[model samples]
Target chain A: MKNLFISAALVVSALSVSSCKKDDKDTTPTETTGTVELNMAHRWGMGADNFLLNMELVHPMTQDTMTFTTFKYYVSNIKFKKADGSWYVHPESYFLVDLATAGSEILSIPNVPTGEYTDMEYTMGVDSLRNVSGAQSGALAVANNMFWSWNSGYIMVKAEGTSPNSGSGSFAFHLGGFMGSNNVVTVKTVNFAGNSLTVTGGHTSEVHMTVNPAKLWHSSASLATTSSLMMPGATAKTMATDFYGGIAFDHIHE
Target chain B: MVVSLLITSTNNNHSPLFDRGDFFQNMRTILFIVAISAFLFSCKKAEIENYKEWGFEKPSHFPEPHYKFENNTQTYDRFDLGRELFYDPILSLDSTISCAKCHAQTHGFADHNVNFSLGVNNTVGKRNSPALSNLAWYPNFMWDGGINHIETFSFAPITNPLEMHETMTNVVAKLNASAHYKEKFKKAYGSETVTDQKLLKALAQFMAMMISAESKYDNYVLGKTTFTSAEENGLQLFKTHCASCHTEPLTSSFGFANNGLDSDFTNDLGRGLVTQDPNDNGKFRIPSLRNVALTYPYMHDGRFFTLNQVLDHYSNGIVQSSTLATSLGTGFNFTTQEKQDLITFLNTLTDQNYLANPFLSEKKK
Candidate 1:
């Protein structure tokens, strides 16, 4: 009995010592920090007055007089390619660009990781996953007026108003689709002139891009023939294709 | 040395008696609890299984579904939470009526023998309570085809004063008041405070997971069995006459069509209310025929009480209209045997498996 008691005591003493040691080990100090930001800017084609939707502009190519009053589209999934060749994607990233709002036109994303970024990438329209998923919040919120109440999809891009050639007084185009032939989600990439952006020791930088609205009508037939588009169809396809193709990397500001 | 020895002896004498065995046991228990807590917390991150993942499960012969599960990834937890909220009456104005009230599982999640369903305060709805199944495969919702996206679909029913009679703000407030709902919201969406966004997401999660691909017709298509001669002939007739508007697999094309309901607008403009175009004067969304046997009387106004009347309208009662479907330009002519056969074919869409599926039923806990 005495031997058994001694053995029990030793085991108890060992457990106590080991548990305390573990408790001390768990409290070890460490620091982990990273920064990421989304920088955005807007640019118009040659001799365009600050880019407003539906403002009458004489097309250089077709020489047709068209007045556009509304131009808006969704931009989401901002990401940066690191020097290590991996991408750091921003979560729940969505943006609505109304050419009317100057602030919205220049999207600034802050808190990006301090690293050397080789390239920047962004989506032109809402992803397919967000389209089918039910009600959303933040930039994708229904209150934003970008969402269609009756038809269950985001108006990824809305361009409306009237043209002189068209007989009708108005033209409205709400373009959006996330599946099959109508899927218009485009991913764009920008390499900093073969030079990497060095973000080190908590520094801020800007990635500038030039987006031209004129390209929206490149492949889309003249405004006189098809002046309005409200739903996903052949017209939406032509306009979306032309507009998405027009997005190019002008230069990096920082 | 003399002073240190004296101090040590005094300290030891004043201290209480200590047992190494008891001290270690307490430490071990505490350490074990901390370890378990850490493990559980780390496992709390949301995953694909957190939402009910429903893919297309239609039979081979059926056409590809319109609702392709596009952006909404399926998961188990999201579906479970959606199902819970669907049956819970906390979403209504008075906390009395729920979606399941009008749409019960026994009647293919439709109403109980009523053409127009009763909403909050016993108010009557404008249209009939259509069956709720195979919704994920539907391109459009409602009789007018007003709503476009599946995510924004719940707003119409929730905000319709004659329906739930509750705003999203009020529903979120009610959900936030209950500790049970808070707990559930945290489990499903990683938060305790319930918002309209989360509520809508959860509800959609439940509604979208409702797949109604299992039926007699589905079985026959899968080669599990063969259809009766009457059902087979009816299927052929449907392929020729009805399938254009009703479509297949999901049994609806989700487009606006005027089935010659009237030669002119009488009361409701249906799809015209949205477009405001004179051309869309009398169009309405084509209703799915998945559970047509149970979800009657037919049409947006519930005008027909029986299948024979509906067939009659298609056969000889088509009124001429500018926006009428081109298929019904003249009108179909069917005999007595053909009508009976079409009815039999409609019966083949009744999904007994879906009606009795325990997963869709009220969860006990």
Candidate 2:
């Protein structure tokens, strides 16, 4: 009985010693790190109505009554600027925000250093480097159907819907380009309006941002004029610009 | 560890002699643990062997390859798997058209003397299948520079409606179902589960190694041989007339150019369709002249049947267009002798070694 008790004690001590060694070997001191969740609240039109798939919604600008079946886009290369003029760039920050998946709307950026961020910067489309690079996994995987199989570039923004105003009875706009003269990749920065976002360790903070889908046709023609855009070009440039430009930071929740 | 614990518990029972049944049970447990650990250790060794770095020989004269295998490290096993996939028709919807169906190893990896290759169900395609040699050096793929990466290049043909017409998801499922492929995948990727990334990377591994830098022209350039006087004259003519677009050594800029193929540009917008730039209408990627002799049915649409016809098109048949190449506006006014000499020089680019390279050929079962 004494031998068994001694053996058990030795085993327990060995396990505890190994675990302590592991904690000491960690690359980053975990106590000072916190997670920042950027909750992208998507809405339809200018009225900020709830954006739901398979729901009929009248366009605020075009006045074209439409029922959206699919809406998804890529948001990547997230960076937060500190009050000290230094930037904390998130590594491998690529997210495919699909309307069908509720959790995809909330992009959780973990391991952020505990600090006050004055501005946030993000790219609306997948960067040119990743588009040219071969065979990406996770959100950038080809299984997601966001990538063009033939052209080999990400469809930065995809909006498919049915409309009575079109001759084909449907509209599909897949906008993307990542090369010179044809690039639609946009980088936008939001100033936080003098309110610094303080990320405390062990506490999750949310940065709420609003997206307006109606801005896609803001300066472009109605669905009746052109219902489909499978490849990137002039119409894609205008539509993607308007839509990407419309994304704005609303407020932050501590 | 469990066997030792069991032995300790049995010893603690204080029996005068060890129970034969308990002893046998403990032996069996020890054997099982040994077997499991041995299997796990072998798996770890296999994984290390799978990722073992293999060097690819790049010719001294040639430029650096566009694909450096950053994500998918090169291994012989992965390359072999890619070769198997390239020749296998299992990736197709009906299990008929593999990548090799359109891209044969012979004839410089282009279709066999056909203007446009037939796909699954004998369905004719719109564009001529381009040669597949020296792809590692190509900045972009296809005649329009549509595909950007060598790894993702197979996805176009595999999923194209007129090509293999199979979805990536379905391909993965089919590969998973095959015990032969499962074993191959396990050997290559350390997992029997197949993925689109693995499949594409494997294909890229095989494709990236299809180098064609041993042509007679290459020999002449490297001072290993001498070009005939006529061939030399033709080379000079080519340098003065065509080297701007069809750059030297590589014989391709891999950039889109409006070579005056069409004046209307209505039927197929070509690169313009991809770029959406009005100025880019009637533009197509300049093809490599590495094995131009074998990869006949030339041009994007394979409009020209013979090299003579191609030369004729350059000499007198250039159509005027708004987006016409500035150099090609006035055609190359060459005499019949000059044309013959140029054709001779072009023929010297036929790399017989590349055409009959046993390494790139279909692996016979």
Candidate 3:
């Protein structure tokens, strides 16, 4: 009877130890960290065509044949929302996405806490505070040629291309505004549908987003009518809004 | 909690009767003490650093400066570098025109009595170069208040086709190529990389220190000296007529106003071009009266050659415009005596100490 009691106690202790180990294993992954990369895919036309710099492409709406030489825009204030309603804000989150550079499309946000993120939010332009604040580094640097020297504001979107339809044989649209009625800063948020983004330890998760350049001329006139815009105005407002609205989250690779 | 848990688990085999709760409580107390000490140490360090750094000198009588130096911390090395860059002609496209070429120190930092200052390759600018003093007090920069920050103000002349006419990228490249500039940059900033931020901030550090608070007017206001009877009378008249727009102490109200400079806005829209509102047509930033005597050829287009002309414009030369300030009803009906008194009072604003401060002048390499 004593021997039987000893065996039962050993079995109970073993069960308890095994259960504790399982609990430890379950909790360890919650402390893991990983990086999340935002891949912005740019396309030229409404049909989701490849956006190659210096490649000739015809706009579906304007029907103007154009070859883009330079296309760059500011993307900033990136934030990720976890499943538990907490947010992870990327520090100094500013990027100048230029079409000329191949790797510029991928914005790798490192040191993100491991968790299942439900939504991602980002701004289409540099914030007004940074615009008013003097001098900035990284992507918002003046060397990027995305800053307006005269007006003291960022050129949030720049699209320069050569078109046969244009009067000057080229078109340049520099869109930006920070304050008052003509402000063009746009904030966009996208949910991952029902698919939760699982970020594992030392793993890289990618969120792919599609950007349509043709949407810039969605509500505006053809390049033939108005080719050059060096300042912010009503036409810039319409074009920037259309382009910002067209950006959508496509998929996430966890 | 994790440390305590690990300790308890590690000792579980050695001691079966170990008091896990007591161990955890003791560990928590120790951690609390350590964290408190660390926080206190950091706070003390921060306070010492703040006191050690050179801060903005705020006179008791003056209002708080508009620029708080939020990002750019003021330092002696940074200011020295900025002074060198301000006097360097390498910032220009042709390396012939420095900022000092237009904004000379002797002429109250305004161009040398020129209505329109010339830029690189003898390119003439549209408007007069304003005096660069007490810029830290300015809410916005330029005649139209287009440039919001003082750091960004340099970008206008540097890139303007009629000014320095140099791209920021090209300027950076040139600075990078120079071994001397690289060494200066290394001394100012920790690294040798001459970025736009470093360049602008260093310039801002030098410009922010261009305070002109030692004028005769400032002395009189501070009870260090007394104003003459004519000057005192002019001050009273100025209060009644001009003080609303050109506020006292700092001299100008930094707000946009159309002082009836023109009836038509076709030539230059002034503030209208920036705001894009037709109502703001012909409106320009109120010119500061500090060192007004030295900074001649005033107004946005430098149409007025002297203080007398400016006074004449206010007294009689105010053209009818829709955006004209309501204060300038017809004109200030100033007699010759009143004009002379106002001019005498205005002369007291010239800070001779600031102009010849030697600190603001070009360093003799």
Candidate 4:
């Protein structure tokens, strides 16, 4: 009888151990999160199609006769708001958009927590404080030739090269200053037309945005009269306003 | 708890004792496991190092740094890279000049016995090579306050026809060709392709680490050392006369004001060129007083070779201009004894440790 009792106890203990092992094996795989890719196409005026970098013609907008030698600007603080009113901010958000390069078109927004989004927002230029402050890294790296060494500030929008339209042999206008009246940093917002984007597990979304370079001349003076702007002044302010006004939301694909 | 568990188990082994002793032992084991797991998790925490890194060593009494570690974080590798580039002649177009060629460490990082630095092809630069120290605290760079960001600072000297005379694109190509530079760039920027961005960042890492706030003046302020009677008197006089523009702590407000140097205003309208404002004509940024005793041939033109000449400029040579600093409305009248005392105080601003510090000097390859 004692042996029978010992055997029954052992069976009970064995069952308990088996149940513990079963609990440890509950590895139901969670769904893998996906990412959204932002494809930005820089455009210019109504008929203008291409962006000119160092006098090289590249079709980006549709058709434009603008020949540029230097074109560089900073885009930062990208955030997308969901229909549920939650925000997905891209961490360490900084990007130097140069029209001269093709590979730079794909602005990667990574490690976004899985969620649904409805709208997007971004800044046209670097914040004012960063321009005044000294030294920076990554997208704001001064070595990219986007910064002015003589006058302290990021050349927020550098458009230079020779143009017959311009009376002078060449032109260089580096418009940027984040302080007082000269602050050119512009924030842009685009609504997704009320369509909810499903950023769920195993999903990918692509958003297309359009930027116009001819907007730089919208309210500003003609290139014939004014050709040079290396510092912040009335000319820079006018040029920056016209350029920022040309930015528009293109479309979203999921 | 173990003993109690043993006693309880000794009394009743078959029926699985559920007493306080067993409960306590189980709780203790769980807590220990949790503690160890927490420690391991913290150890596994990953860090994403940025492209640039280097910082000033904070002393006990120093104020919050002016050039706060912004995007540039502090790291030992980046600092070493910057130190190497600082002493390397490869930055020059002809391999004949390096940063150390002009800013020698023995002279408090100021050029010794030369008014203007001789560049490639023996071309003379416009400005003197200023003493380079306590840079992490400086808000602006160059006498004209022309260069804004520290990362972009090297571009001026590197591309200046009278300096290194190397183009940024060409410099990147040259560095990319070198295997050693490729490895260094890979370590710092995670890439073998040497770009202008990485080159400037590495140079910044070196320049930003040049802090020189440990002079006798700094020591006196920190309460570590007491100044002599003459030094104290000189300090008081400096506060009354020179402290308005040449502020304390950093010893310069990083402003552009005409200090009565070039009254005729032929071409050197210091701050006026940047602003294009007539009021800023003939104005220049105030320089830091650190190592003022050694960085002779003073002023932007390097015309004054002695401290007394600089004092005389401040004393009887007050030039009237719209952009002249209000603090220098009237020239300072210092007696011979007072001049000597002021010079003595200025001598205390020289950081001997900075001049002789091996960390800032050329690192033996």
- Candidate 4 on B241-294: residue-level lDDT in tens? 888887887788778788887667766777777766788888877888888898
**Top TM-score: which candidate number?**
3
- Which candidate order results from sorting by DockQ in descending order? 2, 3, 4, 1
- The reply for model 1, stretches above 4 Å from the true place, is A1-108, A112-133, A142-148, A153-254, B1-73, B189-197, B272-279
| Chain A agreement with the truth for model 4, given as TM-score | 0.79
Distance from true position, residue A64, model 3, in Å?
2.2
Q: Going through the candidates in order, what fraction of the true interface contacts does each contain?
A: 0.51, 0.79, 0.84, 0.60
Q: For model 2, what is the C-alpha lDDT against the true structure?
A: 0.88
TM-score list, all predictions: 0.59, 0.82, 0.85, 0.75
Interface DockQ per candidate = 0.26, 0.57, 0.53, 0.30
lDDT of each: 0.75, 0.88, 0.87, 0.76
Show model 4 residue runs off by greater than 4 Å.
Answer: A1-35, A48-66, A106-116, A129-138, A194-204, B1-62, B68-77, B146-152, B167-173, B181-205, B213-236, B248-250, B264-266, B272-279
Model 2 lDDT per residue over A160-246, tens place? 989999899999999998877668999999998689888888778899999999899999888999899987777788899999999
Instruction: Single out the weakest 10-residue window by summed lDDT for candidate 3 chain A.
Output: A24-33
How does candidate 4 score on lDDT?
0.76
Least accurate 10 contiguous residues by lDDT in model 4 chain A: A57-66
Q: Candidate 1 or 2, higher DockQ?
A: 2
Candidate 3 lDDT, tens digit per residue, B204-250?
88888887888999999999999999999888888899989988798
